[model samples]
Target: MAGYGRSDEEWGQLTSVGLAFLVERARLEKTTTYTELDATLRRRTGLRGFDFDQDSERAAMGHLLGLIVERNRPTTNLLISALVQYLNTNDAGPGFYALAVELGMLPRRSSATAKQAFWIGQLNALYAFYSAGRRGA
Candidate 1:
């Protein structure tokens, strides 16, 4: 939970932007890369978004995504971050799985396949929740 120089209000705004973008993407049954999300955040917030190449910034994005998860956990109980993936590899970062384990959504001692299963489950749930009734409407 490092602040990374972002104030509470800033975090709130950034998280709001990210959540809205992700929800919309989910409704379209689409996935976005970290760089794409960062660009969207910068354009929407008028702030210098994370470089994403830097480790610190990557961690910051993870933290921001974690906040998104925490914000919607009560209603959805799903990792919305599952819709986000690394650009080089079409997979969520380790932090995504870490957050799942931290929240007890994924078992701590799970195998790689088990972890992937959990991520896929969350993603399918997200797609179902948002994509339902969104098409041809």
Candidate 2:
């Protein structure tokens, strides 16, 4: 995906949600260090050199989110907007599952839990938002 400029507010919002997802995943997986999470993400996505600090999960997540948002600003902003809209109109959930799936962060054939399904919807909405933005651009 191409990068697009985003406001500070948009970046903050996206970072917040992304961090939440990372934290929750860490908690669920019982990870004690940022290295674990970094390794997991790399293994799952087949990417490398994420710059995880190895100090704290929170710091690592912040750094990773910053890099991802900066690298894929348009899609990240659309993901954040879709997440916020879902939160306001529907329910609480991580908004990154679909983005994750697209980026190979999650497996495509994996059956989503209820919470994940909600996020999946947000992911689908992101595609719609991105399409609209591309047209306008």
lDDT of 2 by residue, 1-137 (tens): 11233345544544454444443432333212334545555554444434534545344444445454444445344333223222124432233444555655457666647545645565564445444234221
- Ten consecutive residues with minimal summed lDDT in candidate 1? 128-137
Q: Report RMSD (Å) for each prediction in the order shown.
A: 2.8, 14.3
Alpha carbon lDDT of each predicted model: 0.84, 0.43
- What is candidate 1's lDDT per residue for 1-137, written digit by digit as tens? 43987888889998888988998888888889988999999999998899766888887888899888888767677889998998877678898998998888898999989988888888888888877645321
TM-score, candidate 1, is: 0.91
Find the candidate with the highest TM-score and give its number. Answer: 1
Question: Which residue pairs in candidate 2 collide?
Answer: none
Candidate 2: where is the Cα deviation over 4 Å? Answer: 1-50, 63-112, 132-137
In terms of lDDT, model 2 sits at 0.43
